[model samples]
Target: MTTRDTVHELLRRIGESDPEGVAELFAEQSDWRFSWPDEGHPSVPWIRPRASRADVAEHFGALGAHHAPERNRTTVTRILVDGDDAVVLGTIAQTVKINDVSYTSPFALHLTVEGGLITRYHIYEDSLTVARALSGDTGPDRRVP
Candidate 1:
C-alpha cells in the first residue's frame, strides 16, 4: 500500500480501538513524540515521549486506561501527503472514563513512512484540555468562553 493508504488504514485501526492493528503500521524502532509537557500532568502519563513499537503500545494502553476509546471519535479535516511524509489535521473527542467527562481537541499529526512502515510519528494536541479531563477536573474554569 502507498504511504497515504497506510496512514488512512492506521487511522481506521485507531478509531476501531485496535492497538495491535495500529502497532502493525509502525517500524520496530519507530519514534513517537507527543508535543506536550513531560511533567505536571501525571494524570496524562502518555503525554511523554515514546520510542520503539513497545512504547507506542504502552502509550495506547495508557490512553485506554484513562479514556473510552470505543466512544472516542477522530475527525480528520485534512490530510497532506508528499513522498514518505504525511500530515493529518483532525479533531478528537473522547470521554474520560473516570469522571465521564468529555473533551474535544484539535490535533495535528506528522507521520513518516519508510519501507512500508511508519518510522516517525509526532502528535500535537490540546494538552490542557486533556490534562483536565484525565484529572477529572471538568469545571467551568477549564472551559474558555
Candidate 2:
C-alpha cells in the first residue's frame, strides 16, 4: 500500500480503538513525538517522545488508561502527501475519564512511511486544552485574548 493508504488505515485502526492494529503499521524502531511543551501546565506523563513499537504501544496504553476511548474521536479534515511523507489535519474530541470533562482540539500530524511501515510520527495539538482536561480544570470562564 502507498504511504497515504497506510496512514488512512492507521486512522481507521485508531477509530476502531485497536492499538495492536495501529502498531502493525509502524516500523519496529519508529520515532513518535507529540509536540507538547514540558511547562505551562502539569506535563501529561504519557505525552513524551517515544521510540520503538513497544513505546508506541505503551503510549496508547497510557491514553487508554486515562481517557474514555469510546468517547474520543478524531476527524480528519485534510491530507497532503508527497512521496513517503504525509500530513493530516484534523480535530480531536475526547472525554477525560476522571471527571468526564470533554475537550476538543485541532491537530496536525506528520507521518513518514518507508518500506510500507511508518517510521516517523509527529503530532501538534492544543496542549492547553488537553492539559486542562487531564487536570480536571474547567478552564477560564472566558476565552483568553
Candidate 3:
C-alpha cells in the first residue's frame, strides 16, 4: 500500500479501537516514541517507547483497556503526507480510569511508512494536562481551553 493508504488505514483501525489491527500496519522492528522526557509523568500505560510491532499492539491495547472506547475521543484536524512521511495533527480527550478525571490535549503524531509498513511512530502531546487529569486534578486550566 502507499504511505497515504497505510496511514489512512491506521487511522481507521484506531477509530475502531482495534489494537491488533492497528499494529498490523507497522514494521516488525519499528521506532516508536511517545512524548519525550517521559519521566515525571503519570505512568499512563501507553506513554513509552515501542520497538516492535507487538509492543505497538500492546500500547494500543493498554489504551483501550485504560480508557473506554466510548469515552475516549480523538479528533483529527489535519493529516499532511509527503512521500513516506505523514504528520497527523489532532486533539485527544480521555478520562483516566483510576481517577475518572478527563483531559484534553492537542497532539501531533508523526509516522513514516516504508515497504508498505510504518517504520516510525512518534507522538507529541501536552503531558502536563494529561498528568494533572490522571491525578484527579479538576482545575479549569487542565483541559487546555
Candidate 4:
C-alpha cells in the first residue's frame, strides 16, 4: 500500500478504537513520539515514547484506561500528504474518567509511512490543557489564554 493509504488505514483503526488493528499497520521498530514538557505535567499514561508496534497497541490500550471512550472524539479537519509523510490536522476531545474533567484541543499528527507500514508517528497538542484536566484542575483560571 502507498503512504497515503497507510495513513488513512491508521485513522480508520483509531476511529474504531481498535488498538491491535492499529499496531498491525506500524513497522516493527517505529517511532511514536509526542511533544510535551514532562517537568510539572501529570504522568499521562499514554504520553510516553514508543518504539515497537507492541508499544503502539499498549499506548492505545492505556489511553482507553485513562479516558472515557464514549466521551472521546477526534475530527480530522485537514490533511496534507507528500511522499512518505502525512500531516493530519484535527481536534481531539477526551474526558478523564477519574476526574470527570474534559479537555478539547487542536491536534496535529505527523506520520511517515514506509514499505506499507507506518515508520514515524508524532503528535502535537496542548499539553497544559491535557495535564490540567488529567490532574483534576477545574478551577476558573484553568482556561488557557
- Which candidate achieves the best lDDT against the true structure? 4
Worst 10 residues of 1 by lDDT: 136-145
| Prediction 3 global C-alpha lDDT | 0.83
Off by over 4 Å in 4: 38-40
Report residue 40 deviation for candidate 4 (angstroms).
Answer: 8.5
What's the TM-score of each model vs. the native?
Answer: 0.92, 0.89, 0.89, 0.92
Better of 1 and 4 by lDDT: 4
lDDT of 1 at 124: 89
Tens digits of per-residue lDDT, candidate 4, 44-64, equal: 767866799999999988887
Residue 16, candidate 4: C-alpha displacement in angstroms: 1.2
> In candidate 1, residue 35 scores what lDDT?
66
lDDT of 3 at 105: 88
Error of 2 at 130 (Å): 0.2
Ranking by lDDT: 4, 3, 1, 2
True-structure RMSD, every candidate? 1.7, 2.5, 2.0, 1.8
